[model samples]
Target: MLLVVAGAGAAGSVTFAAQAEPADPLAVYAARIVGDRARTRIVLEFDRKPEIAVRYIARPDRIVVDLPSTVFTFPEADLEARGLFRDIRYGSMDADSARLVLTADRPARLVASEVMANESGTGYRLVLDAEMVSQQDFEKLVNDQSWMTASVDATATAQRGDRVGQSEPAAPGAFVIAIDAGHGGIDAGATGAATKTQEKEITLAFAKALFDRLKGEPGIEAFLVREGDEFLSLSERVTIARQRGANLLISFHADTLRQSNIRGATVYTISDKASDRMAADLAERENLSDAVGGVSDTGEPAEVSDILLDLTRRETQAFSISMADSVVRSFEGQVALINNPHRYAGFRVLQAHDVPSILLELGFLSNKEDEKLLLDPAWRVKIADLLAAAIRRYRLPVVANGG
Candidate 1:
């Protein structure tokens, strides 16, 4: 309903064809998501010519089409009809065409979408049917937009010593473990009463340690979605995991509160309904990370209906809870435990549907013992080993149940 169509152009005529050679050769345009379930569609137009050949392929989690130098933008009206997608993202893949990414609110099954000739000339239309995902899943999709950054920084790229550039072979079937360091940059999380160490710093150190251990393990790989002490939106956290094709996502956090007795670790997965009142409150506070940090949530009202959103929420929650249990058990003896170690909260960062994700509170900064342990290198290594094993163990059930 909120399409940004200018309504320009005559009513009847449409021009269709890709130009062969003009003053400069025109490149055809293509769009598709680029991960697990690769679904692709393309459109080409020219004033007086036709395109030669373009290559497209469908991967397990994404769809990609390779074309000549071309840029793509959404035609306003068609975008409005989509109640499913939260955003459409793209960047230049190379000097050739661009890579288009779509984030959907609910999991979707792409029946068919294409750009072809109409009665008058040429046009583009894409169609998709929604596959219901739980509210947890939908929220993860919504949250992902914030986690991803378009960094093409050379030094950072070089720092990624083993990372593949655009031309490298896709890391197919590589087990993806999503690492989330609970708070970042300005978000100090919990503070040590005695040592005065920040929770953000401890979590980042621990996350990086775990990432290194995962990388060394066979058949397993890991990456921290956030590399620095930068403020990242919770949704962006989930986006990082999904983009990396993570099968399991683990978010790290260490916090403090007035309740001095509270200590030890806890594992949390997303839930449509919070598991307990305390869990609900914790989730509410975390969800407001963006707003609390001074980002405005007040904006133009969404035209999407409430009923449809609720329907999607009903679909994927149980899987989220299962992930929490997987992690709590994984760290059983190696880490300290909190009351009812496995918990459920409405965390935006733990929302990806296809991937099972959980948030783990490494320990409470309120406790002196916990704070010291958090700063220890030995604890980081032990915790990382426990975490990696849990990820590999969790995969068995997910594959049998979902795939």
Candidate 2:
């Protein structure tokens, strides 16, 4: 149902009939990407042409396609590294809308995009054409769409509270926590040798359990960055936490090491240099989530330079370290701990400049004992309780200090 052809041409308008009943939504049967470094074409076959809107975003340049809520049945492997694209991700944005995001390795310009009926007249296909452009031209494109950029900025400002280091009045009895369950959709993350379980599944299980426990606690409002099996860029994860005004961001994972003998829980705070070799390797693997999930690293440029921003980053990092210490202290004796227990690494998920964040490795799936414990419902409950306790302990002092 999908076809990719070279060259480009103008597109004609098309229309669809209204549905009377709730049935199956538009379905994508096939898709393909073609072309080389200069130009690229993308074709998506569907039961019928659906309404779609396209936009461009800078700072790791991307082309975003917004479509009516549709079901995607395409194989995950089909999206692996292809021409002009580092990665492609698509998922439901909400109840009535779906989104397809294409990450480009270089600045790209949209030549044409249109939905047209197949020549045979049975179905329709969405065709998109883009080509590389100079950095100056790309900057112009971004500026031409300044209105859209302003809207995005407004949304971010509304969501984020006080600027870094600037204390603001706290919301009465409100403590927001962002729980990120690492690796989802195409990125299965580490696999267990003994149980053949995937890290994504284990992280989601633990994250959900922790969310439920926190919801029951008074004055604590907790939510997951990802509610199901969907992919989110590393930057997106941090942005979501900050947008929701999260006081603390906790990323959960269960990774496997080459050496199966190493097994235990460990907590990591963000730092320029890793605390050890193991921590550095773990951070490297975790930071590759976007690439593993089929997203191209468009490379984000540094934000505007300011002394306030620098101070805010330092304060946030300090709070992150304090939170990590609390987690290690709470887990002591309650669960098996790694030698150091607490470490530091440059984890991308912990890079929000204003939010305190930490990455928690529940245990090693490579170890038989750790795998068994990770799969046990009873053990999960105990660990979730311990984490909630840690959060409570960290929150008390911050609330008292008006941090």
Candidate 3:
């Protein structure tokens, strides 16, 4: 006895409704969209009442919905782009948060959003109605209301405070190192020209090797940002590292470049500006992981106006440079390194203000020789050992001084 609109303008279609408890405590079982350019309706059926928070973003007009820990069980095709919505995406923001982003072809605002028990009385429905709005109005909305959630800038400020009051490490302090394997799930990164080896796979393999090598070392604790083929936003990566209390974060990547002849391992640290055109171009593409995964940019402000946070970032950047230098020195005779191996760029993944971070390019997949070396297990092991040595050398003084 449920009226189901199978698709846009499908008025006669009727489907029986079935409700079952989802294994997860909270979940979205179904989703649909209807209507046209000027206005639209979005409906989602949830297993239970969900606490939802909404935010409006401009530049490219979009609406973001934040939810508590919840599983999305609906078919991807269910939320087809129609009406005012140009694109729709739903995914995990982190371990505890999920997000739904709706991008519009033009400025649009949700005029109505409500949750109510369904006719079956076994589930709940979240209904949203959006309509086109003037660009001026949208801009007004964007400026008038402040997003209350902890944005990247706010989180970094909090982290700055955390570092200020940090206590000395225990005897033989176990330094936590976060190994982030770049590009996974929907974002398949760059491809190897010869072997067609996915960059995600290569990065993951090297991350595991590095983690395995570091986990057994004394005074070191290592954790992977991702365990499998899963997508994580750039901001989410930073959040995870900070949550893990990581002292250092090393993100591994194997990228392909336009110049096929250019290839070697390179180390990158975050900077306000790129050191060179190549670094800038690479950072630009790497920052688009979220867009590639169908998620709109959060459009949250990145710059922190707080003086304490700025100071923390500067100090962290220095430590990152020191770590990068250590890596370059370790790879000098042991592994092939790019000219001026250490580079700098505005990499979003390295934006954790209190945690020193570096992104290591294992090799360029564009070069046949580099790709071959990247695929070799023995070569990966050798690189992992060298990286371990670098980390150990870098930590010696810090550990002795009670980091």
Instruction: Give me the runs in candidate 3 sitting further than 4 Å from their true place.
Output: 1-172, 299-308
For model 1, how does the per-residue alpha-carbon lDDT over 42-157 read when each residue is reduced to its tens digit?
A: 23332223322211111112222222333444343333323444443332322323333344444543444444453456543332223445455434543453233122222222
Which regions of candidate 1 are displaced past 4 Å?
1-170, 298-316, 400-402
lDDT (CA) for every model shown? 0.50, 0.71, 0.72
Residue 289 lDDT in candidate 2: 72
Top candidate by TM-score: 2
True lDDT of residue 275, candidate 1:
85
TM-score of each: 0.54, 0.67, 0.63
Query: lDDT value for candidate 2?
Result: 0.71
Candidate 2 per-residue C-alpha lDDT over 134-205 given as tens digits, one digit per residue, 9 for 90 to 100 = 888887887787687556434333333223234343467688777777876556677777767767767777
Q: Candidate 1 overall Cα lDDT vs. reference?
A: 0.50
Name the 10 consecutive residues with the lowest summed lDDT in model 3: 1-10
